[model samples]
Target chain A: MSITEIIIISLIKIVIVLGITLITVAYLVYFERKIAAWAQNRIGPNRVGWQGILQPFADVFKLLLKEDIVPERANRIVHAIAPMIALFVAFTTYAVIPIGPNVNIFGYDISLVVADVNMGVLYVLALTSLGVYAITFAGWSSGSKYSLLGGIRSSAQMISYEISMGFSIGGVLLLAESLRPIDIVNSQTNLWNAIVQPIGFITFVVSAFAETNRLPFDLPEAEPELVGGFHTEYSSMKFAGFFLAEYANMVIASAMIVTLYLGGWHLPFEQSLGLSGIWLTVAQIASFFVKMGAMLFFFIWVRWSIPRFRYDQLMNLGWKVMFPLSLINIIWVAAIIMIFN
Target chain B: MSQTSNSLKKRKKDLTFWQKIYIPEIAKGLALTFKNMVRPKFTMEYPEEKFIPPPSYRGRPVLVLEETGEERCVACGLCSRVCPALAIEVQAAETEREKERYPEKFEINMLRCIFCGLCEEVCPEEAIVMSKDYELAFTNREDAIYGKDKLLTPVSQLEDRIEFLRKYK
Candidate 1:
């Protein structure tokens, strides 16, 4: 392929990924409200448009119209850049995730993923780790004690959880014997990694929740304590950036979980269906999205179901429970590989 | 050798292996929420679909206007005095009707009214009863001080509450 062709294809892929992600992020917020209301047996946002379908757009408009207030004592540059960095990290991590296998369109082989890097998994982990800076910067720049505390807590929490997360991923890497996401997905042909390494899966899922700063693990932005957390001084579309980034991060996390553990895009016994090449590819892609949707639903469901963990409890779980558990998972995976192979 | 009584000791049992894992417990919680997701939602879509409060439901206090277009209040000053928040203001005037005294100017400052049901309970002539008018939105303070027009509800409308007060009170 020519350089122009490559650029065009890359541009197209980027647009497709970003477009889907933004739309999903918007609807995720809408569904989060709906699901929360359902759990509490109350009607959520239904007045905006046809059962509050346009609520996300309405929220964006409201945020855009609001006054962008920066605190007098705040570091204006850092405060402004924090959410942008978050948005960048959250969105960029999706570039390497293979939503579906390679497909041939118009006799040209087109990979569903944008950038199929050799170290795709590492890229995702590194980018997600960079997300810590966004929160920490927001906290420090806000010039509020609340924001600073939130930032500090998040940094500590993210660092603690990332250890378990990294170790958990170590098990998957052992099985796949590759750092690439596509290879990881391909390795889990019949039995998923989730079934094989249940402990690792559980630890990874828990750590993902913590990494995303979701409920139960959301000590950094514990609303009652931190009073809006790191984004206390943020207003207008800047705040919306963080909001968008958070939901986008959820989408990416769900996708990663799907790709890593849930057998991304490849349905069990799908090969025996005797379908055409195009149709099979389509089915696989659809399968990937379906799994992602389910994972996202689980995320929202768990959020509403479980109350936030205390700071001490969170630390204890990370260190005493998750860390040791993940380490044990590595041993378990090693044992299975040695015995079976 | 002192013998310790086992009966008086507090049992501090450790968590079992399964409980220590916590997955089963978390699964139980997830299942509970999942079940609730499909259950009959008790959401009353307000404004579009107004909630019909039960007969016992105490809403805004309203003056009962009989079919004769005359209020049931005889300006006894009982309801005004009984209002804990001092929300009611009644000025009695001489009338040609069988009830010689009638409230020429009756007002209830809903801002002050605590919806305590005291005025409804203390009504001597069954004049003032709480009606199912919970939507009390006012733009300003003056609008919130409900006058005779705003406070008065037809006897037909307040029938459920009046009957309920009679049955229970």
Candidate 2:
């Protein structure tokens, strides 16, 4: 491809990914509410549209119209930039998560990812770590005690969990021998990383929940203690920015989980079925979405089922349990590699 | 320190190996909620489907209107006197009818009405009773102060409450 062609293709991919991520984030909120209501044996929102399908748009409009209040003591510039940082971190991390193998489109070969970078895994880790700054800045700049406390809790929680998360990924990188996301997915063709190293999968998932600030690990946004936590002082579209970023992060987390552990778009037993060309590519892509959807559902289901962990318990679990488990997982993977290779 | 710690001590049940692992326990909880997700929802979807409150329910208070279009209240001030919230006002006037007296002006300030059933309980005439009209909304104080016209319910519509009162009260 020429320079212009490559630029156009990359732009098209970026637009598509952004659009899909935004739409999915909106619907994910709707489904989260619906699933929560279902878990409690009550009807969820249904007034906006059929089974509340259009509720997300209504929510966006409502948020857009709300007054953006800034506190008298607030650091205005940092407060304004916090949500933007969150959104940027969330959306940019989705760039390297390959959803499908290369496919032929109008005689042009195209890969189904926004940017196929060499150190995609490292990029994702770096960007997600930057997400901590978004919350911390929001908390500190808000000039509210609740926001500050939330920021402090979030910084602590994220740093601790990220350790286990990194180690868990270490097991996968050991087998794949590449930091590239596409290469990791390709390595899982024979057996998914989840099956090979169950401990790492579990630790990674728990860390992902903590990283995304989902319930059971949502100590930062502990409603009772810290009110809206890091977002206590935020309102209107700025608040919605944080909300969108959280869900978008969830999408990225699940996509990364899929890419690293669940074999990405490679359907098992596809060789025996003898699917070829365009049909095979289509099936593979669909399979990737199905895996992602299931993971997303599990995330929602767990949120409603489990209560938030106490701060002390959370720290203990991260350090005492998850860290050790992930380390063991690395050793287990090394053993498997030694035996097999 | 030991005494205080002993006082604050909890009887903690030691978890088995499987329970301590946490995964199986979490799976059990997930399974339970999944079952509930498929179970019948209890939501009434208000406005579309109204709840038929049981006769025992204490909602807004109403005066019973007889079949002959006469009010069952014989200018009784007992309800007004017994109301803890001082929500009800009744002005008695001489009447040519067999009851000999009737409420000339009756007003219930719903804003002050606590729905305690005190007015209903104190009514000797079985005239005032709690109705199932719980959906009360008002823009102003004047609108919230329900007059005799707003308070009166037909005898047939109030049969459930009256019968319940007769058997239980």
* Model 1 chain B worst lDDT window (10 residues): B1-10
| Residue A218 miss distance in model 1 (angstroms) | 0.6
- Candidate 2: stretches off by over 4 Å: B1-13
State in Å the error of residue B108, model 2.
2.1
DockQ of 1: 0.68
DockQ of 2: 0.87
Evaluate candidate 1 and give its CAPRI docking class based on DockQ.
medium
lDDT by residue (A192-294, candidate 1, tens digit) is 9999999999999999999999998888888999998998888999999999999999999999999989998889898789988788888999999999999
For model 2, which pairs clash? Answer: none
Question: Best candidate, TM-score-wise?
Answer: 2
Model 2 lDDT tens row, A186-267: 9999899999999999999999999999999998899998998999999999999999999999999999899999999999
Model 2 TM:
0.95
